[model samples]
Target: MTTRFLRSSSVLIGLAVCGILPQLHAQSSPPTEWVDPDTGHRVVQLSTEPGSESLYFNLNPFTPDGRKMVITSPDGISLVDLATRSVEKIVSGRPHIIMVGRKTGQIYYVDSKTENGATSRLVCSIDPATKAVREILKLERGQSVSTVNADETLLGGTFTERTDWDTNSYFEGGPNRRTEARTADQQRDSKGQLMVERLDKHYPMGLFFHNIATGETKSVNRGTDWLGHLQFSPTDPDLLMFCHEGPWHKVDRIWTIRSDGSDLKLIHKRTMIMEIAGHEFWSADGKSIWYDLQTPRGEDFWVAGYEVSSGVRTQYHLQRDEWSVHFNVSPGLTFFSGDGGDAKMVARAENGKWLYLFRPELLADRSDGNLDTKGLIRTGVFHAEKLVNMGKHNYALEPNAMFSPDMKWLIFRSNMSGATQAYAVELEKGDAK
Candidate 1:
């Protein structure tokens, strides 16, 4: 499908203009088009694909340490160190669930290996310093641990299976002749349960916690909600957060619980048939959780932050562009990608644009800094556009804005010549002073 963006000057100013005062609407200026200030250009393009071929790039949450990026390679879970920018193969096969510790730089993932010719996926880890991948524990074949703590001490994961039943004999009517409209995975009973022939088996899909320090793994034993997108609390490593995609045919979930499998609390729920803000996250102080939800008509997306104690939810609305604005992926956030809701970096799906930086101070308060949030907002940077409906889209942009450890240089990835590469833009000299 085609995506469109709105770039009216007023809207761009509306989003980018957040400060001490909250304006009711934006005033018109020339459509603030997205241009690299240094080169004076519009549209930072990446990749050499013919015409809008989807290019896949992953953001490494653990890259801050300059050690490794957790990536899925043909040789299994691989760690690419930015210092060397080299991909090191740590294990082989589909290590489906992979996580990297932001503080300790430890990498964890799921590896399915052949033991006596039988295959199973297990929770695994790789130490960047030693370049070693080791198995921690083995669960049922389909179970995979998806998140790990920064210290590599806690792990969370999920497992799923299908329960099927026969339709011909169970029905009140005589044996049915045809089952035309059913795939094995699609057929379900009246109560939303799978129709399986055995009639006695229950598919126990659940979430679990692992004490990496003790090697003692405990099954969470929650209901059949498909649990995933797990992470440990930054402040209290013993706490865990996760999203549950209820039943095989349901939407996403947001939840938080303790590592020892106590106090399972459902944070958010929706009846929609989409991922919702299912790629969920929590705030640094464990006071809130954040997630994304697509608009009801799928016209746009919204980012949400939920206060853990008060259960107050706040939604950040993103202004949409009327012109085709194709978005294939969600902008992956940085340190906040895990349990703590603080997100440092975010990626743009359209044109592979990136806005990477960490501003813990700004997020702590309500002051929206130099970012324009109203127009073409991705990864917290706003884009202002002109022509209410089309050309010269205004963008409240911080082109190539990445922060140093102390929020110094705004490093960004640019492709002026159509080759994706890295570049850094120093904040206006006096801005820091």
Candidate 2:
């Protein structure tokens, strides 16, 4: 499929989501195009690859200029030039790292050995222009969720000793490493049964800060338990966040620290009323941490935000109609989007996965109850064109949808054609949208 269009139904957002908003219709700039009834935005598909398209959620797929895209597969790393619609293979095998420098436009990826093997991992930076390769950091431990600072002078990394099967975690309790141990080392256990049973040791996961210019890698902090979802603050280059990557109710899901490793502090702790907060992301300006708030049993679904400096929090509660796997805010900070509602659509179906946008400003007077607002809409529903067992594994394609840095477009991955490829949808302007 080169491109297929989806028109908004004359659905009432208030009726579907319990009086969340008034009746709204899609206002498409191109009259023939589909306008999202929720946000009144246009949606477009940017790719139709025949094989498979994969992307990491923490990393922004767009390069410095948004002219190129980066993706990976079992075959290796591939680059897509958005303007020319071309694909270039950068590496042969799946690397340990895949990232794009925000300011320098340097393509950074890693080549590594298996976790049980005694080999070093190489973190490489490639100049997209010259295709020159530079090995920046070499270490015995593997890195996950590594990202660059806003200015690109430094890189933040999370190094965990847990032997994981898949890094792109969208679900839990499938082919569990601890229970389904493969190696002799995995059969044994240490203090912790599950993690130590999977690996020889349960060393504390280390969070590192690497200076690009100085060629120095410093250990900022390390934890003995599960830790991941590490990300650098967009506005504050020296600050970063990590979490105990487990059930939200079992652990404090959000924490923040500095590059020098000092001032290590927890960002959010669950209270009796608000018992969980995970799937966290920084605000556009880095002033607050935005996340979904819920109870232990997954009731009281809410889109929440916390001001980092003032310790004040604001929440916009959505009706308990359906649940979304993740929620992301636009760079403009005017709307928030969620996925996974209707479950009937297959790879080609867009039923349960709709592009839901909610406005927080309209709920200014409310804090912790069902939000009564008008800026709610379902702009689009996403179902992959085709589904494939990537790498011949149990994993299937997941649409890690995100807004562009400029917030003018939304980026998502799917296998609508034969292959998985990156796709973009144009957004309407502030006034007309």
Superposing all C-alpha atoms, what RMSD in Å does each candidate have to the true structure?
15.6, 11.9
Candidate number with greatest TM-score = 2
Per-model CA lDDT versus the true structure: 0.43, 0.58
* lDDT score for residue 11 of model 2: 43
Q: What is the lDDT of residue 400 in candidate 2?
A: 60
Worst 10 residues of 1 by lDDT: 336-345
Tens digit per residue, CA lDDT, model 1, 160-256: 5654324322221111111336531243323134222212343566777777779777876556544455667655777777765433224446678
Q: What's the CA error at residue 320 for candidate 1, in Å?
A: 2.2
The CA-based lDDT of model 2 is what? 0.58
Q: Lowest-scoring 10 consecutive residues by lDDT in candidate 2? A: 386-395
**Model 2 compared with the native: what TM-score?**
0.68
The most accurate candidate by lDDT is 2
